[model samples]
Target: MAPKAQTPSKGSKKAVTKTSKGSTAGKTEKKHKRRRKETYSIYIYKVLKQVHPDTGISSKAMSIMNSFVNDIFERIAAEASRLSHYN
Candidate 1:
C-alpha cells in the first residue's frame, strides 16, 4: 500500500518570504570590464621588415601608415555594424 500524503491543517498558515531588489539573495548584475586590444602597427612593421630587410620607414611615414590602417579598420567596422543592424 502507498503512504498517504500529509496536507497542511486549516488552522496553520504558510509564510511566504519575498526578497527585495537590493537584497543579496536576489541575482546580482555584474559589470564586466572591456579588454584592451593591441595595435596592429607593430605586426605591420614586422611584416615589412621581413619582406625587405634593407627597407626602413621614417617615424613620420610610420605614423601616416598607422593612421591609414586605423581609418580603414574604422570604415570596415562601421560597414559591418550597419550590415548587422540591417540584417
Candidate 2:
C-alpha cells in the first residue's frame, strides 16, 4: 500500500500564503490613501514683497512677477534656439 502525503497546518508563523493583490504591508485597504499635504503659509506674499521691489508685496503681484519671469525665459529660450540653428 502507498503512504499518504502530509500537509502543513495553517495560522502558524511557518505557514505561507499568497500575498493579496495591490495590498502592501500594514495598508489593508485596496485603495492607497494619499497623505494630505500641509497648506503653504500665507507669509509667502510678505516674503516676496520684501525681496521684490515696486507695486506692493501682494500675492497678485507675485503672480504677475511669475508670468513676467516665464515670458523672459521664453524669449531667452527662443534666442538660444536661433543661435543653435545657425550653428
Candidate 3:
C-alpha cells in the first residue's frame, strides 16, 4: 500500500514551497496589494492641457499618454541614477 501524503491544515501557517532551483520561496510571487501613489508636477499638467488636437482627446487617451510619459521618465531616471554613481 502507498503512503498517504500529509496536507497542511487550515489553521496552520502557510508553508513555504521549494522551487525546482531548490531555493526557499514563500509568497514572493504574490503582487503587492497596495499601489504606489502617482503625482505629477504642475508643469506637466500645463503642457498636457496646452497640446490641442483637431478633436479633443478623450480621458482614456489622456490616461494612456500619461502612462507612456511616466514610463519614459522612469527609464530616464534609472539611467541618470546609474550614471550618477560613476565619476
lDDT of 2 by residue, 1-87 (tens): 223222234443244434543345447655567998432324545565578846455567666666676678789999999999997
lDDT of each: 0.72, 0.58, 0.60
Off by over 4 Å in 3: 1-45, 48-54
Model 3 worst lDDT window (10 residues): 10-19
Regions more than 4 Å wrong, model 1: 1-39
Of models 2 and 3, which has the larger TM-score?
A: 3
TM-score of each: 0.52, 0.39, 0.42
Arrange candidates by TM-score, highest first: which order? 1, 3, 2
Candidate 1 C-alpha lDDT tens digits along 1-87? 223333433223332222343365446765478999766668778989999988988888888888889999999999999999997
Query: Which residue pairs in candidate 3 have backbone atoms (N, alpha carbon, C) closer than 3 angstroms, thus clashing?
Result: none
Q: Write the per-residue lDDT of candidate 3 for residues 1-87, one digit (tens) a residue.
A: 223323444223343323432343343454357987674544455675688423355567667777887999999999999999995
Deviation from native of the Cα of residue 71 in model 3, angstroms: 0.2
Error of 1 at 59 (Å): 0.1
Candidate 2 stretches with Cα past 4 Å from truth are 1-56
Span of ten consecutive residues with least summed lDDT in model 1: 10-19
Top candidate when judged by TM-score against the true structure: 1
